[model samples]
Target: MISVDGLGPTDYERADAARLTRLPQHDLLVMAGARFGDLAPWRHPEYLRAVAGLPEEQALAALFVLGRQVPEGSLPAPLLALLSHAKIVSVGSGLLSADYALVRLEGLTLLAAWRAAGREVGSYAPWVGTDTSTLCRLVAARRTARTALDLGCGTGALAMTAARNGARALAVDINPECLAATTFNAALNGLADRVAVRQADMAALDLGERFDLVISNPPFLPLRRGALGWLAGEGGPDGLDFVWAIVRQLPELLTERGEALVQFASFGDQRGPFCAAQLADELPGLGLSARMLLKPPTPPRWPAFAERDEQGNLAGDLGREYRAYVQSIGATHYHPCVLSLRPGDGGLTIGRYS
Candidate 1:
């Protein structure tokens, strides 16, 4: 649970909601794109210049949203104190820096560890990315459900979002830090009673129960291990490690009328995401029908562990090594997709985002 400057979440929800509202919706999205859109181009000069042009409140909010440091006095004292009490920020030497980032999506306030803040967070810091956003939107669309399961859970945003829709949600994750964050966020949003957390590997999960709804944004990166060798980002030798695991369990995990949504990136050939073919081959055997939403394709990228030179260029023959690896996998394009599944005869429809 989160405390706001000596007050509990209930008090904050009743009295301090306005002061904590970070930024306008449009401004927030732009800031997020600036902060996290390009992983390789880690620094964004144009984004900084753009933030320099917003109104004072928005500009200050941008500093925290982008995980940049500013003078302690620059932000309102009450807001700073509230965030500080929640362990969302740290103040030292009269400067304020973010430990967590606050995001308001679909009328829900969510907290996640700030990746750009350069803080020494746990290996499984809550993932808040495009995939999270996509799943949250899908959760919000479901007005109600008897029960919901969030396989990855991350910040617990998906579970909380489902709880808000009148569903009892069980949030599962292998990372204790992630479970802690989810539990705290559930209380912060006044949904603690409706949400429960458990630590478990989704790859081999069985709880002797089924849910009316299920959702996940599991790790799909093809790297065997990331720079930190974190399991949260690794998808084994093939990117389908977790994807296949989830597919294997869906038949038993979902109720008769249940629905599931999973967002992940997959290697693609000229035809499209490999899921299209995998679904035809495997999902039919499971008696599940699917609708897939795909985004435009991009070239394969080197893993996060690829070494970089002083100028951020690929070090040594790392580029050649990455090319050979991509060739060995026969993956020319990277596809990001959300797959929706339900119990039915094996029918698959694929649509691309414009």
Candidate 2:
């Protein structure tokens, strides 16, 4: 377990670190999942059309990645120092071209950065997947909490964000790499003192602890092998194996007045569409209530969203593997759903976002 006590940067460091946060990093963050070239595995282009036209400092800051470089003597001395400060707190090694291999969330100056999620130990990068941006937003919408727990907190985005919202957060994951990433991100965002990193499997968690809020974005992909390996994204054949385990334990993990925002997925088998409604049915029996926040239905169509990337392009092998994976599990379709759960019973509301 990594300590949260007095874990933030020194007072002097914080003043310098604040300067680096003002750099142009959000454009890169928005384009994270997009691939720029036509080649297989797609290269993450450091220079975008939008970035190429900007001023020197602003352009370099926008498209910076593993090997991109900024012109020397361009930024102020204080800002350059802050850049080094950001890198010192970053973990793993895909090599960051940006001094910090991090990205800012919309409306938040604080960043969530990770090296490419790989098979290396202490190197679990949580690819901020398709629906996670929406999930993070939903998590942020919840009222403040004194203490929060982010179960399976890969790269600790939820926990880091929770800390930003003034909560003491515990980011727990089974992988050491993930815990390390969480620790790095917590420190990177100047919230080390407010976020603790721990290693714990969701099924085996028994810390004798409970939180006022909880958030999770578990691996719900059905593939057991290939891209969905043991390192980061791994859920059994149906993908719900991990989700079911977490959902069963949620009521016990939250406080009486607590609420939780969880991201979920349901795959359609020949048997039936195992959707949010099915999960909501299970929650009531545990003295909990669930409301579906975003579930795409008619018109917009959920399948299109699942098979495409941020740029509305098919993700080559990833898309193919996902479609085949679900078919292997007897599921022809899979759905994305986010739910807000709370202690005690309440009405179940299901919704769809366009």
Candidate 2 per-residue C-alpha lDDT over 211-306 given as tens digits, one digit per residue, 9 for 90 to 100: 998888887655453353455465655566667777788767988888887786677543334665567678778888877755542221223213
What is the C-alpha local distance difference test score of candidate 1?
0.71
lDDT of 1 by residue, 1-354 (tens): 232335456545544545545445423442455466632121455545555566665535555556567888876666666667767667789888766666655566666655523333433377665567667888899876789999988888899889999999999998877887787677767788899988899999978899999999888766554533675777765566888889779999999999999888888787887667767777778989988888888877555444666865446654555566678978888888888899998589898753
Q: Say what the RMSD of model 2 is.
A: 6.8
Clashes of each: 0, 4
Count clashing residue pairs in model 2.
4
What's the C-alpha lDDT at position 291 in model 1?
Answer: 87
